[model samples]
Target: MTKSGNVLQKINNNYDELSERYNFTILPRSTRWNSVNRLGFSSTYLIRQGRVIEAIEVAELYTEYQPKSWQAYESLAKAFEANEDNLQALKNVKIAVRLVDNEVNKSLLLAYINQGDRVNMQLRSVKSLTLICLMLFLMVLTACNNDSKLDFDAFVEKKLTDFLIEENAQVASIAIVNDKLNYQKQFGEFPDGTKPHHDTVYEIASITKTYTGLLLAKAVVDKKVQLDEDIRVYLQDGDYQNLQHLGKPITLRHLATHRSGLPQDFAYTSADIKSGKAFELFSNYSEAKFFEDLAQYQLTSMPGETFQYSNVGANLTGYILENVYNQPLSTLVAQLITEQSGEEHTRFRLEPSEISKITRGVDRNGKIAPLLSPHSFAEGGLTSTAASIADYMQYLLSTQAEEVLLSRTLLTETSSEHGHAFFWNTYEYHSANPMFYHSGGSIGTSTWLALYPKQKLGIFIATNVSANNTQGKLNDIANAIVEKYEQVGQSK
Candidate 1:
């Protein structure tokens, strides 16, 4: 019997071995020619079945069924490939890959295409090489399973993608490091399906805070700034004179931890936006303007009183850092994120200007929008690619990077729960998990970046669909992926 047919025979025989949901494996079992998730079983199915007309049906579903269920789509692509519609097949496959999250399945999908070395080679009948290669990839996934553990690489892919799909969201990329003797994989988009490439950029809304927060962590360790020092002391400018008289001081600790009594976002005064962009929040940015902003606004609660998640407070963090470093916040981020992390594609400076390259925040209907305004650079100015952000998180997992950016004592403080930071917020410290996390958003943008330092797991998820609050969606996906990876580690 052909290897493809044999491999299918074996998987069908032992389908019970696949992990379901949290266990990380999702190998569907079935009987007869119409095996369930058979499209996922092997690439051989495609060489024998790919055709064109059916592929169009899948594209139409992008608008109809939303972004889920890739099997119908992959089959359509397979039909196209079988019928010699290679270009059409490639195009259809892009959408299919986007719809899928299962790592094992996506890898199986790529088996036939990896034959790009001789795409021009013609075959009169079904080539035997295809069957051999296709079966091997399947066996590889099956082999990675030991006792009951799922493949680490596949687990990351499936969990994250499943989470995003669950959120009615999609991630452009999920960067991972699953060393071989295991799977090492990457999934998702760039400007043009490119590689070593820029496809993973998504509008990581609040994750912007994590980048700035890391810089603050570094600064506190450097002794250039103290957590307890009044931010007003750092800023000699009269623009912050209102802060000088707030009855209580707003310290760096309060700003970083978000315990300072600040609003979540700027609920600007009529004078500031009466005739201007009412929601164009960052249009009036200047040190003096900030003081005016502070003086004109009333403190809803006492400073440093309780935990409130104030974007205003976070932005103030950016301001304090910039003021102390004597540099622009974005520039500092360049040194902190890109230079330090050895990342090349990540940037906050938009093309020729300053545009976030990840997913640009989305509008009401999940259309791309802009994150144009923030009063200060530190609070919300960084825009990063998933790969770069993931790399940065991996850096935090390092004792080497930690020693540079922080002292053990300050790192403890940054991760500590100090009651409240700002607007109605409570910090949940995950000390046991040793997670470095932050969520961010700006109008139509949202993002989540987290790292389990001890576990050596880092996940950065960004979606282009903004104003949709992709934070929960991003985390759900990250958690799913992390769960799979941790399972693999524990199984070891």
Candidate 2:
């Protein structure tokens, strides 16, 4: 048997062991089918290995195990698509679409169906082509009619409402900024039955990394640090011999660009967070604790040669910034970012009055979740509101500040489609229309921020709910809004 076959056999034989090892019980109930998820992954892997028939067989097994699941049908559709069986792909995807419960999944399956239809059209009979053309004509006519009546604000409101209902989330805030427009809105009410307004605060989570990145840019501009300088120069108290790999030391840029060989986090794991252990663990975590973990850390790969999303690296950057400026991170944020941006409610620390304004966050299971602690302030602890984030977005869109500009500069190219600046992920960096964006997720909230420099467009979206696919949902909403905005602009 092939290696893949042997692996599949072993997984089948040790199903309970795999379930226990992976802690399948911690997953959302809807996604608790560990065998189905693994089978889908195996099918994708087999397809990538050029084992198309085996891939289809695995997908078939997935559907057999979870016949009613849209995900299973979707997986099978993908396998058939890979095998160039457009008819089968379309048939499976249609079923997937029918079975899908949420708008996000339905939207995805519809796209696949549309693509498959286009491909299958070439092979259709002349009569079938005529019918398809008739359908297209009607679709175009309906779209044109809808476009004539489209209100950007109403469209956005509907999208946000659908998202809230689909995710069973309580509240969300969104801000959009461009040269011609500044818009902000809050949707839904808090658990207390109080409606969230423009200034209602919620944890922005890892979006805080962008602020840290901007601070690093300021340090570079001020000549306080060099991008390629060995980070150990500032860690004089500890012997971090493990911070280097293959004679190359981790640099400030490596940390900023996620190319530093640091672990994802030192304080807690995903399981810990799911089990409510992370809150306890972080309660006592300090700068000293972080450094102690760093001293014992081993490099997994050569510095600047790998891309690992490391909150530890981001926090370390924050620490380094603090050391260089001789100021606390909170003070630095106040002086450098929020103050300059005129963001009144954006902060690492909140007062009692401000705390009262913070919205309650809900998790996937509809339970109220604990707000993020301040210990990970640099990495994921900042909280803000739609109004303040609007100001921040406008600040980013209009500012010509050297440090802000430097922060958006592509520091490392991870792929043709993806790169990294100071900490922001970059897309199409070498093209005329470059973009910088980041997504953040805490235990109870998720957020996404994106900046389109060429378009002078910036968007910030946050929800008081965290789920496995919250970021993807937000990205879809952002994309939809951007598309509609462009359509409106063109129409005007």
Candidate 3:
């Protein structure tokens, strides 16, 4: 076996030992490896390690052993490029993208090669070029998330009490994006609980995944990527799995919707995530690491089979987006979602550098903890005011400018979006009729948003601390408001 193959075997063995703790899932046959794209795998590792020829040889192997594997072909192209063999790389990339058939991977291959050298692919569109932010912006406009000038700005400051602020919650800014609005709110100290300020940020944990979901959708619209294709074609070459047991051939859509069968982030202790701490569990993880782990993850269920929440699954979605854009996930957020969402005021980190610009997260106990960053923003690494969060909902729920910024064609089946997390769907609470929305919570922050597209109604709330039973309280509040809106709508 090649040294790379040997290392993979050792890693597999170590992972097997680690699985003794939980009920381990067996790798499926389709994903099972034996010697399909050996050339592609070798070439990929070599290129990553800065070795050119070995990488080329790796790509060549795909042509020999697994003539069908696009991974080998893409690697061949990449290896060629690294070796300055641009011609060969161009020749193979065409075969790779068509063969692999994944949107993100196709984007990656496209990004790696030059236009003149490309093998006969058609040009992409302008709107598709800026799909993430631009597409959503247009899609949301259709939802009637339109905002009106608020005389309440004066009311909030003049008629309201400083209750949350006096309790240590720092109120940042208030913004309105149509019927949805967000407030800039922050609270408590920094890491280890020190003197805190207004701009203290908090790790958003799983919220990062929601943003990743949006990116997936945008990629589809851009045509820079597709969601209905096999994932192997987009991935770096290695041994095993040839799409036989991929559960239904995991697609970008499946991954975005959390049905791709990837696991949540590696099961690791908190201390292990920290560097130099314990040779940690999730220590070897970053975007690249995420894809590697994904290649090994077992498909407990088939694609679109069922709903199972997994961080690693979501992380892979973000990772794929990054691979296609040739930019970091954080950068993608800044350019696409953050900029277009107009939640530009919102930042994705858990620090207290800005005294008047951050929000603190609280748990069920309502106790404060340290902040977090957008490193995992694809899951939950964002802090924003209730108003800003609501504004985001506008894009999701609005019907006014559907075809403009928030296209109606994007989400026709509301039920598909309603399953677990974000995506407009109805759930009942406090005997209130169905309300479509999502909730977010962490160490010292509690956020809730509700949108009734049918009624053109919405509500947003973000607290610096989690209210143990306040969820019921918010539900009560939301239902009450939604009910009132319904009654008013009927009368009209």
lDDT of each: 0.52, 0.77, 0.48
lDDT of 3 by residue, 1-492 (tens): 322334334435654442332112322213213323333444556677786765665456456443435666766767776786544555576566455523445555554443524332222534324333432443343222212112233233331224344334433222222232223323223446564332233333444455666666566666667767776656555632833254458776566556666655564445553442322333334655654555566665666676555666666666667777778777777666654443434556434455235555554444554344323446666665444454455555542332223321222232533443232223442223344555555545555556555544556554555545533444554455445434433212
Model 2, span 442-476: residue lDDT tens: 77888999998888898889998998799989999
Worst 10 residues of 2 by lDDT: 23-32
The Cα RMSD in angstroms, rounded to one decimal, for candidate 1 relative to the true structure is 17.3
Residue 424 in model 2: shift from native, Å?
0.3
The local lDDT score (0 to 100) that residue 105 gets in candidate 1 is 66
lDDT, candidate 1, 81-178, per-residue tens: 65675555555665564445455565656554455431222323465355345445545744555434455555666765564455444344555432
Q: Which stretches of candidate 2 lie over 4 Å from their true place?
A: 1-150, 350-353, 490-492
Most accurate candidate by TM-score: 2
Ranking by TM-score: 2, 1, 3
Residue 124 C-alpha lDDT in model 2: 61
